[model samples]
Target: MLNFLKKKAALIWAGNHVKKTQDFKLNAEIKQEEQLLMMVRTAEKTLFGRQHHFEDIHSIEDFQERVPVTDYEGLRAFIEKMKKGQRNILWTDTPLYFAKTSGTTSGSKYIPISKEGMPFQLAGAQSALFHYIAKKGNADFVNGKMIFLQGSPELEEVYGIKTGRLSGIVAHHIPSYLQKNRLPSWETNMIDDWEAKVNQIAVETEKENMTLISGIPPWLIMYFEKLIERNGKKITQLFPNLQLIVTGGVNYEPYREKMNELLGGKVDIIQTFPASEGFFAFQDDYLQEGLLLLTNHGIFYEFIPLEEYGKPNASRLTLKDVELHKDYALILTTNSGLWGYSIGDVVRFISKNPHRIMVSGRTKHYTSAFGEHVIAFEVEEALKSTVAELAAQITEFHLAPQVNPTEGLPYHEWFVEFEKEPEDLNLFSLKLDDEMRKRNTYYDDLITGNVLQPLKITRLSRNAFHEYAKAAGKLGGQNKIPRLANDRTIADILSEYKI
Candidate 1:
């Protein structure tokens, strides 16, 4: 009876919350303008703001003209000052926490999470759930166990502020009302060894009514594998109530087939676009294929044409300027004091009615050897289509260019671990090549012009990715295998595990 009342109350609250958010979605342009102005006004006296003449900025053009677009390297100096307990280096106040993440360009990046900005991050996540609840008209999941596979909550103090992975920092902010339903135990969560932690998590939650499982898709797959191995039963057979999955960090389409098989049934999924930078977007409607862009969240957004990314005169565009299906590099000026920061992601607007977007790829994570410029989405789409046609399942895959081959022309090398290998591996490779050519005109031209040969697939041993990640000291907790690489660095390392 108590659970029933709680669920009923939750449903009511969700309905109201969704309605409120709809208003903002409808007025996204105005909301964004307001948000930008508010942030500028609040941080006008800060060192970064003063340097950029934020007080003189009265319009989007003024702000854009004053602040130059930049990446992590551009903000490193300011971040260093903040790490040393300096106040107002970037924002009006010092940061409450620093979310630590491994960087591709640098060794480590510490992103500030200010007290003023943290609530929006939490709100965005909560709103995703509430939207799901309102749309599905179900809150039964709230009454059952929920697991968020994450980093250790134990934090180190950098100066006076807490410092840890974004997931770990978020652990401290889970609402008290739902605390009892969250898992695994504190001791299990604190375990640094990912394999050991996953084993403990599988044991701890196997008997519970797990309804919502949330994490990056790869690590969640690992946890699912652990559960099935230990119990010799499919995930749903053990939990029975498992219904919803919330995932981010990487695209989910490539892993969907395997995830469904592990679940033993079709389940609802909410794909989110979250980073240590901020929770940018989330799948608000299960029927939709794109995430609703959060214009009213404590951040102002800008987009630059992907093709013009590094050019000196690259156009900085607001929401009104974006076109459908056009790729843009995502940029931000946030309440956390990230000014005109390039988050390194490429996205496409699928809908403008409520501003829905699909994360296409990354600015830096692509294979451009031989000038073909193969992107993450193009390769993933190729693999997805081929898998569907061949009725095969992929455990994991990575793409890298082979600049020189011992016996043949250079080609794209695919490292794939298949759960269900096709009867004819050669045919599967040909089909994948065909799909790739259909998607990327540059790649097709290269193959036809004899600059590159058809792609080659190298089968990998089971758990090859696990071995690679372990060797790199990034085995779990938001770590993901790079989907595409320009050079052979990842390819040569993965070569050692080839079957």
Candidate 2:
């Protein structure tokens, strides 16, 4: 009953806060500056009081200028310090939990998400719910149980102290009511029995009335494909009450159309931007094109110009100072003891009044082969267009940069799986290449020999990629098949195609 009341109270508190923020109005610039000041004050209280890194930061400018920008590496060092029971460089007490993230770009980062950080994560989830509510203008459709396709928490012993990743930590914090019976009952140790977990989800979801689903896009896509194959129309026929689908952890644009089709074109979709470090943003309204910054949360924000790299003479902008349409890389100082940390995500301003922004992509998640720069968003858009034109069902896909040594041309190799094989694979590849060029002029010039030839597409056997990810111990729940690769490592992994 206490747990129930806590959840109910939290829901009410979140609902009221969303209403207040949505209704509050101020000059976009003024509002941003105010939020920045609040964030700095909070950071000073939380981070400065706890660590030596910001002990010298006497002012906001002083904090920015003196404190060097940090990434996951710095955070890891901090965690090591905590393990020694020493005072953290930022936090006074030990972190409540460490959020684990797959280190696709760099190495895996274990971010210290504090007890204060839980509110932001919860707010991010609430924002999606509020967006759904605001769109339908009613809560009538949310009656069915929601399923978060998350990693289970059963620990695997390496040295016997209990460690997995951020997913395990987050899973532990889930409202008990949500987990008492609603969560997938598969074993939690992901590395131990991924196949058992996947089989469990397949069997359990088949029996329940799952209305809302959340997870990384690639895994969800594969799960739905598996469901369709197993009990044809079971998704559409069984889950008549399913209404909303929330996804994050990777780009959704590539699989948006395909996902829409799988859901029978009746569900409302909302995208979120969350990381082990922080719960950044969520789509606040169905009509709103981008996510709204969680200003009242325990996170402070700063931005570096996208064009500037390698420590250029760029001034970081607070939320109030950010301009619309300008691309910027994010630097955050959160309550979780990270001070002026660069989370490595890039975002563009969509609005200022309520501080709405779109997650453009990641700094390292880009391809610059042949000098034609292509980020995840652009690639996602191109894939969406290709899916529409081909009228094809994409089971899974990955884009890798390939440089031809003989021709000295750099291009992209697309590894894709479709529901039905195309009659002319070469023609389909050409059409996809043409569409990508059309979407970005930089790609067009590259294809015309200024940089490289057109991209090459390789069709994989049905469910082949899924099987490979499963084999690699990456299948089940939230683990997704990588969608974009900037190097040949992923390409090499997928190259060994044996049916």
Per-residue accuracy of model 1 over 1-499 as CA lDDT, tens digit each: 9989988999999999998887778889878878898999999999999899988998898898899999989999999999999999899778999999999777799999999888888898899999999999998898899999999999999999899999999999999997899999888989999999999999999888999999998899999999999899998888888889999999999999999999997689999998888999999998779999998888899999998999998999999899999889999999999999999999999999899999999999899998888888899999999999999999998899998799889999999999999888999999999999998899999999999999999999998998999999989999987889999898898999999
Off by over 4 Å in 1: none
Worst 10 residues of 1 by lDDT: 22-31
* Model 2 misplaced regions, further than 4 Å: 1-17, 23-59, 104-106, 155-164, 176-181, 186-192, 405-409, 421-424
TM-score per model over all chains = 0.99, 0.85
Clashing pairs in 1: none
lDDT for position 367 in model 2:
73
Q: After superposition, how far is residue 306 of candidate 1 from its true place, in Å?
A: 0.8
Q: RMSD of model 1, in Å?
A: 1.0
For model 2, what is the error of residue 448's alpha carbon versus the real structure, in angstroms, after optimal superposition?
Answer: 3.6
